[model samples]
Target: MLSTSEMTPETIEQEKLYLDLGLSEAEYVRVKQILQRRPNFTETGIFSVMWSEHCSYKTSKPLLKKFPSTAPHVLQGPGEGAGVVDIGDGMAVVFKIESHNHPSAVEPYQGAATGVGGIIRDVFSIGARPVALMNSLRFGNPGTGNVNHLFQEVVRGIAGYGNCVGIPTVGGEVQFDNSYEDNPLVNAMCVGLIRHEDMQKGIASGVGNTVMYAGAPTGRDGIHGATFASGDLTDDSDKDRPSVQVGDPFMEKLLIEACLEAIQSDALVGMQDMGAAGLTSSASEMASKAGTGMIMNLDLVPKREANMSAYELMLSESQERMLLVVEKGREQEIMDIFAKYGLEAAAVGEVTENTSFRLLQHGTTVADIPVDALAEEAPVYHMPSKEAAYVKAFQQMDERIPEVNDHADMLKQLLQQPTIASKEYVYDQYDSMVQTNTVVTPGSDAAVIRIKGTDKALAITTDCNSRYLHLDPETGGKTVVAEAARNIVCSGAQPLGLTDGLNYGNPTNPEVFWQMEKSVEGMSAAAKMLETPVISGNVSLYNQSNGKSIYPTPVVGMVGLASLEDITPSFFQETDDLVYVIGEAKPEFGGSELQKVVSGKYEGKAPGIDLQVEADRQQQLLRGIQAGLIQSAHDLSEGGLAIALAESVFTGKGLGVEVDLAGDATVALFSETQSRFLVTVRPEHKEDFETTVDNAVHIGLVTNNDTLLVRVNGTTKIEEDVSTLHQLWKGAIPCMLNRKA
Candidate 1:
């Protein structure tokens, strides 16, 4: 066993050992003051992880308070395993988004696969059955061989876990940029369904309750992972690969069924997933929340690796493990349930009346500390924040529109850009129709899933544009939220609420802190205007490598409610349907795909959004769709009008469009003006659709020509067969991934 003698206070003070564990000298002093004595090695490990930003949110709690987390429909928000929102009829939806960025950068496959596994446990731990899984992924330029490999492995990892667990991998978004070259972001989200009566909290109340360990046996993998994730990645990050947890989806499947069954029994008091800091966080936080304490006998804990030290067992983030507090007399019942699934369920300890977290091994006390000191009293800092001067300078710069010599060629090039290209190469490997609840699969504005035995359905999506946030954090933040709302509205669902994965850089950097502050302000404004409250979220800071940070990529995961009968498709439904643009297209090219394609970089202001206008347009679009006046609806973003129009026909449906737009050819085709959508209305309902949708402009007609024909001001600008465009879009990512460097 690892010895604690080396971690004595004399040696620690002499060597400043806490610095190696990510604790500052002041923090170590504070720990000494709190405990009124020097801590042993196990206690120090507990403090290091529990105080980490990944586990404590010490640096982000103040900023997170800015998000409005409560609404009438929100039953539980922000502080639970996942947020729960009332979906009417005694049913609720639980969902949250989490990032595994640093781990994924070090070990792509396992990092991403365990991210999916951990999120699934979060949902099920709250007694909800996970219904769907989605991901928002960002990687560096795909032309780089290393980036391609990372992208491929991340996709496979997501697919492998979700498919094996029999949950549908639904709609999501992906963006590629050089800013993510060294530190790719892998954010996973899971949506769950449950009855209102089955709601559970991770609180260990009722003194003398049995503390039980369930699921997989603990191992040494993922030790110190919380602290690892809280720090910046460096050239030596690959050495931390051992901190990435290996996941077994089959084991998770069994645990899910077993735990869900166990929750139904009255014996289960509190249950929490061993994620992040693992058992230390789960046990201490659960006890702290209930104003109680726990005395765990580490010798009784199940272990897959023999002779594991108490500290290793406490900190190991082994996948598929859970901590449960049960009614003392009824522990046998819960044990039987877990045993039925061929899993471990042992009585490891008991809840205590005193407010302390104590660990014992081999008939000796290993560590003892105040429960609140570990879980509730992590330090909070309002970091210094300063807006980058370049933000204002860029916004004031005159528009630098690149002259397009051949509009058709430019359109083709934008379509081939990795950020705008098709993602069938990724989603094709996922079983998106698992459990048969999927009503609309991927390749749409948002995914729609039907609620069995009811007319209700849900529209789900994940979205972010990090390049815009890189240029202007505030505007880009609002745009991403508005874009998520547009997608939900386009799928014929009323916006409900959202979860966020705020992945940023070191909080100690004033500029990065300012980006986080401004971005949250923007997202909050848009969410309020759109009436979508922030239900749950996670913050991932310090996403840097070698002192260079990644773009401020705050991903939004949104869910909306709809009637099964009113679901709208994002593709053309019939030939000769009248096509219209719902909002104005401006010459807003900053942070646009066109700019990136032209200059190989993005500068200038990110596009501006009037939240009120965006909200009004979204409501209009949803009303039109629900009133049966619109046939097909799609939001214009990223590659803008040209990409949206092309995507409507890329489903190999043999449908196309002919449009005559009066504007600059380049701006009309490629400008990424927000709050705009491409919609088609049947000729019979054209007048009503126009009346219902404000700012609607008739552009053309959907046709069976299988060709996309466009004329700008009586001049042919773009003409291409739908099949040809589809081929280029589909082959881009796969070809890049398979090609040699």
Candidate 2:
């Protein structure tokens, strides 16, 4: 068969092949202008994947710049393999979050498994040992057979890879909604530990450094994966199954150990993971960062398939592979390190002073281009943006409070809504305590991991409420970031920084563009106010199935710092402890769990927040926790105060609460006002707690009695046994999945 190089520019246009490769006519013209001639087949393929939205961030880059990414402890922020932050005692924490949405939609098992594998590579490539893993998953109604199957496999895939790799899958969250019926979002996050002195970068410096290929062999699978991920899913998307990668965790385990060992050698200069655009991106970016060039003999790349073309070798998104730039004359030393791990390591190219990326196959020059053009010169567009009409309409609509005739029954049903229900069924499949560094497990506000030798620990969490963003993008954005920080604070930690996974719909649509723009603005303001700078992140656009788009879900993966002694529990500790509610609860039910259950859809304005108020309140609550005043602390979300109260009770020992709430019982229990918390204080420290946190309102008392009782307006509004509430809350998801189609 003739290669793409044999086709003339006229033939390429007649066949319209570039359009099939996710390139517009205007982009094709720009490529030709950059080259000063028509690009051959392999060169065209390189340009196509490098310029795709999945790799280039052409539309979102301008918006991303608005985020606050600097702080005193931030070692490295944005534009790297993973963000790094100093955690004291010469150690740093490295973390990042990325999405594998399109591939997961077509092939859930392999797609999710490779996503975990890929993110792990991102951490260790920078000389860090990944200690913990977290995920944020979004899917459709759990009762449907298709959605259940997808959810089951995605969880299994994550457990399979992470369990085998020996890193703990500590914590994460799962939300269900019909907007994600066809297109699901699977965002994976990896956090690693590193010594500042051992840190490495992904730069190919030194004119004569040898470029090495390590880990798995190259194959034809996942050839156009980058371009595939940049586009929307259609009914025919199943045809793109070849773009989904297969992963081997055992091989990755070997790679991780070997890379960590190799990083100790002074001969190693730079390293990068072969993710997204694969070899093309890894090579170009490494070279461009060093202001150097590279020349590769594609024939030297270890291939699993016979007679693979240059294009396939460059663009393959093969899992568990990495690119290394080593000093000349020390290639043998680096190769020997991988040999100890039974991995294929070979010298495939060399860094050059020529400043161009040149590729050769079978003694023939196949592709040659300026490295910066491929790495940094991709076209960026400020797509047209206009406020979504639905936002204004929803804002104008008055809030509708649901009439709860049976308060006890409504509490039971609200707890069963999959969005607010327990995720024990999902986390049970994961190995959360593998390394034994996990101090706090899956059921808390944030997962806490302790540094072995130091007294310090880290609190990590992933959060977002997409339904709120659907109602009001800007307010929802601020709410998500603040909520993430609140989770950390409740765990008795100081907010460090965050990594974001911005998952949105097609940005070409003006309304969708506006959502992205406004959401970034809100998140930026919150981050600045809370001092949780945006460190490293990824953006996944074009999350559309057919002509419909999912909610604008921007997931925040944040980490916080604390001492072991400062960590507080998320459940009640002692009987008769005084219970308090921090921050005022308002009749803000828009995009709330009650609204979803009653209306079966979302409407009305999203709950609003004052950034300064949230920041000040968090500081006060944290101080009380540090002073040993709090017996337990839980953030109010999803099902509102009632659900949070039930969770605090059910997840703990057989303890219950007797609460007397002011205002209408329905609004008091179910209104999801932002920046509120349900905390318990010891009886002896009650006065000190109230003094420390001036806004904390004494609302109830923890009791040995196994019943949750709520009184309002001198009348008993709700009273339920704790055992029944726990059963409904814990069994909702499993019960739905057990139903036969």
Candidate 3:
């Protein structure tokens, strides 16, 4: 190993890796000052990745503070591998969402698979058993660019990892737009169960305790991925295929079980998954979090490749790997647990009293830095931001919107819109019933998974409408959170908390920074009003191509506490059931599906949210669900009342529906209003349900005939066969994809 004293300008000039690693001139100057001189090659590589925007959260941390990350039932918050929340009976739910956008763009299958693999490890690293998985994927329009290939492979990637790991892919979301043509977003969310007492903090503690490496042997895969993720994609992005970490689900399965067993063996101090910056992230973060230091010998690491440099060993983002800090005498005991599962385990380092990070190769110091300075002291910037010009343009375009001629025709068109269409074609490929605990799988308001051996159920949903965010970042941000909470409550669950994945363009661009700022403010206000804290989340910046930013997509993935017995189906079940429309309706057509189908427009600020009214409506619905008065419930979104009714009937078991409204046919049927839902109850229980809720308008009845009929003031406006609506909605995406292929 060469020291900085032995390194000279010739070697640094030849490599000049700083430009390729996304390190700016100022950053390199800072690194030199931190070392009190020029750094050798290995030291330079370590600092560049650790201090990167993807690893350090430099630009987004200031905005993240706007979120409310703590609640009374929260067992763990944002700083750990994942957030944990107590759900009564000494049980807790652990969950988080992470992005693998850049890697997925280069190698869709491997990138997406490792995204699922990494999030699952985050949960089990804290001593939880992963029970359900979900993914919110975004791609270019089906026929445009490489969308079809990206779409098909990304799905296969998620299925390959989740199915093999035996965790059910319960629920998630998928959206298509040209904005994501070059840089598709692959966000994976995993939920796990653990007893509150068994949850482990990912920290390095005890001065003499040994640090062990477990699971797969290290290799030179996905090196500098943290740096790769921080940069925007370009035509040459395909050449970075080596930065995509390959996944091995079988190894991950063994790792999850072995880690859980070891956590309960009373032989561990701390544990964490080696994700992102890999060993560099895990070791530095563990040491930083505990106010301690770690000294590691590169020779002791289990590796598949021979003659690897110290730099490659530290930065390789190898999949299915973990770092464990164990008690002084329990090294072999910990080794025995993983060895039984056929995994490699070795003591590679030990905790120290001093707060320094040191790496030794064959007993010679190769790299040394302050642990906190490496993990936590990256520079934080308050980027300049202002409202973008496009927002005002979208608002002004409203005056040119055209009128709708036929309500029935408009309903049919909106149904065929890809975002609003049925996703069964996609979810059917997933093994959603693998765990046999999935009470309500895909094609529901929220996916509900029953907690085994208990009467409790956990409801989960992830949502974000990029058009809304693009039109009005503040309102769109608030709407995303509100929609997630609405989905949870509609399933008879009280939303406990939420996780977020904030995807945007380069934050150095002031216009993009403005969107991020406004969206966070909206999410913070909504979370406080709904009393659901944001427990865990990931931030994905640099989602742009050729200087064009994608929509400000900050997805809100929410979890709620519910009971299996109280869970309400989103379909109309019985004939003669009375359908009630709750909450007020306004004609706000900013980002509605109707705008796309009928007018080809995206205009106006987002439909504003009245947080108190939204909160009141959720509580009222929950009360009705508990009292056994509400039979079925579904929130009104996208195409509004019209699409909601059509979807209510499109379910194979639904009989039919007839509605009589009170306003202009277009406004009454297609307005993208907030805080509204279509709920049904037996005709006999209608009186009691109406009494319990405010603003409950009886607008429709479930009939025996399989027809979707609508009227305004008893005049026929929309009339169509249920099966006709079903075929069109179900076939749109598959047909488009097939034709494109």
TM-score of each: 0.99, 0.99, 0.97
Q: Candidate 3, after superposition: displacement of residue 732 in Å?
A: 1.1
At residue 614, what lDDT does model 2 achieve? 93
Residue 1 error for model 2, in Å? Answer: 10
Question: 1-741 in candidate 2: lDDT tens per residue?
Answer: 346656656667677678888889999899889989887778888999999999999999999999999999999999889999999889999999999999999999888999999999989988999999999999999988889988999999999999999999999999999989889899999999999998889999999999999999998778899999999999999999999999999999999999999999999999999999899999999999999999999999999999898988999998889999999999999999999999989999999998899999999989999999887888999999999999989999887787778878889999999988999999999999998999999978999999898899999999999989999999999999999999999999999999999999999999999999999999999999999999999999999987899999999999999999999878877789999998887888899999888877789988889998899899999999999888889999998888888988885478989999888889989989998989999889988888999788999998888889999877898899999899999999999998777
Off by over 4 Å in 3: 1-10, 13-16, 395-402
Against the true structure, candidate 3 has what lDDT?
0.89
Query: What's model 3's TM-score?
Result: 0.97
In candidate 2, the residue pairs with backbone N, CA or C atoms under 3 Å apart (3 or more residues apart, or in different chains) clash, namely none
lDDT of 1 by residue, 151-219 (tens): 989998999999999999997988888778999999999999999999999999999999999999999
Q: How well does candidate 1 match the true structure in TM-score terms? A: 0.99
Model 2 lowest lDDT segment of ten: 1-10
Q: Could you tell me how far off, in angstroms, the CA of residue 482 lies in candidate 3 after the best superposition? A: 0.6
Clashes of each: 0, 0, 0
